[model samples]
Target: MKLSQLGEFGLIKNARDIFKSLNENIVVGIGDDCAAIKLRKGFLLIATTDALVEGIHFKLDYIQPYQLGIKSININLSDIAAMGGIPLHALLSIAVPPNISVNFMDDFFKGVKDGAKRFKVSIIGGNVSSSKNEFSINMAILGEVKKKYMLLRKGAKAGDKIFVTGYLGDSAAGLEILKRSQKSEVRSQKKRKLIKRHLMPIPRLEEGRFLAVKKLATSMTDISDGLASDIRRICEESDVGANIFTKNIPISKELKDFTSSQLKTRGTHPADGSSKLITSLNFALYGGEDYELLFTAKPENVKKLKELWKNVNIPITMIGEITKKGINLVNIDGKAIPLTKEGYNHFKG
Candidate 1:
């Protein structure tokens, strides 16, 4: 059946299928009046709101209303999670066009519900309207974290080791493929890595909480705005400079394997011993929306984090150190580099 016939309910029902991908803490108000969450600790409540717009935040064709629905909420959840907070509640508001079907709205809410469920959070309330000609969503999320665990973008310090979770640059590559869809680029290995990373980014809520619990972070920021921007945030907040090494940055093996095979078969150089794939190391460093964590830790906790990486399989790479002074994204080979905030910033474009 076409989406026009499905109406809102049918769309919502369909989006429920991807709920398994988000947090598991949702209790009440999924299909009911306001999500009823039984916060285990009931600490001081913290909240945040973020918007995802049709043309600005995402394109409708690349991401369905359902996926956009889930993603819009998830990114906000990630913000709180970055602060080491447990998400509790959210209020969603949407603006839609007259031509849009009820099914699109339903699918959108279903995504909203499922995403909230992933964080064990809920939609306590929200508004819906049809006077606009575009799709827009805003979710205000509520959560709790210990006062001590409340991480601020300004808490990092000099002498702390700079670390980032997961790999980088996949999302940028993905965007490239998505835009170049008409050219039929046979899905390069590295390109797929970026695409997949961009499409289905997982918010590191649990891992972030774990970091806070262990008192492992001195300063932290996620790579949503790109490694350079987030690192710049931490450094500026701490009144320090950073020196990230090019050698240590982690690019995904999936990217390497895929790209290598594709290139080798086609007689092209997949990666010529240098690790960067789609964009250069500089691009990955500055390219935004990776959503992985970038944090600083005391020297002692840095050691502990290294050991922990093996157990959880969460790679914590030390790209550099918080220094006394300039955001120096340098090379071990003795080159002083000037860095740019190359990641996703609305004003930059």
Candidate 2:
């Protein structure tokens, strides 16, 4: 059945059935004027909202409705994670065209339910509306962190060490492969891995929480907008500068293979590995939506942080250092290049 047949009220009922709150703190969930939840005393609430629109943030050709649903929640959850908070509840609002299928909606909601379950978040309330042409999802997530454990982007100081969790550029490379595959046949294990990274980015919630509770991070931000852009944000907010060492930036072997394959397909010299490496580095620096944490800590905390992080198993690489005032990227040979805001820009034409 089409959404047009079920109508808005029926859709609401379906959503309510699928997303019944499991948390005791949620006094009221769906079917109410407003969702209500009890917050623990001495904790500060953190709220973040993110929207994904068809043809803008995503394309239905490559992304399934289920993946879209999960992506919507994860993106907002990432924001809360960046603030070092534990996501507790969410409000999901979606707009769909009349012709959208009931099964598609079901799959989408199933994804949402699965994501909420994995993250221990409750889908407490939401709204669904008709769209003229495109499908869109707007998710508002609410989380909490103890006042002393709250992390912000404005706390880095000069001489701090900058670190990023996990490898970068796989998502962007995945997206590139997806776009490329539409016109050409691209098949490989690396391609699949990269695509998975783009489709299902893992929010570093545990890492963020550990950093916050341990007071390990002086400043933190999630890499939704790529390292170059996000690092610039931290610098701007903290009134400091950064020097990122190109050699220290982490890129997975899978991503390197994908980039090499792409370059070879473009008729680049097979033996010119340097160009391929440079291309991969570009993706690592500017590719957005990795959803990894980019954080800084005082130089002195480096040893303790690494010691604590050993058990977590997430790869944390010290890619840079907080400088006194300007953003610069130092190459392998110590050539300092001026860095700019080159990440995703919603308004950039």
- Per-model lDDT: 0.70, 0.88
Query: Model 2: per-residue lDDT, tens digit, 262-320?
Result: 56444221111123433677788887889999999999899999999989978999999
Q: Please give the lDDT score at residue 190 for candidate 2.
A: 76
Report the number of the highest-lDDT candidate.
Answer: 2
Query: Residue 297 in candidate 1 has what lDDT?
Result: 88
**Cα misplacement distance, residue 221 of candidate 2 (Å):** 0.3
How much lDDT does candidate 2 score? 0.88
Which runs of model 2 end up more than 4 angstroms from their true locations? 183-186, 264-278
Total backbone clashes of model 1? 17
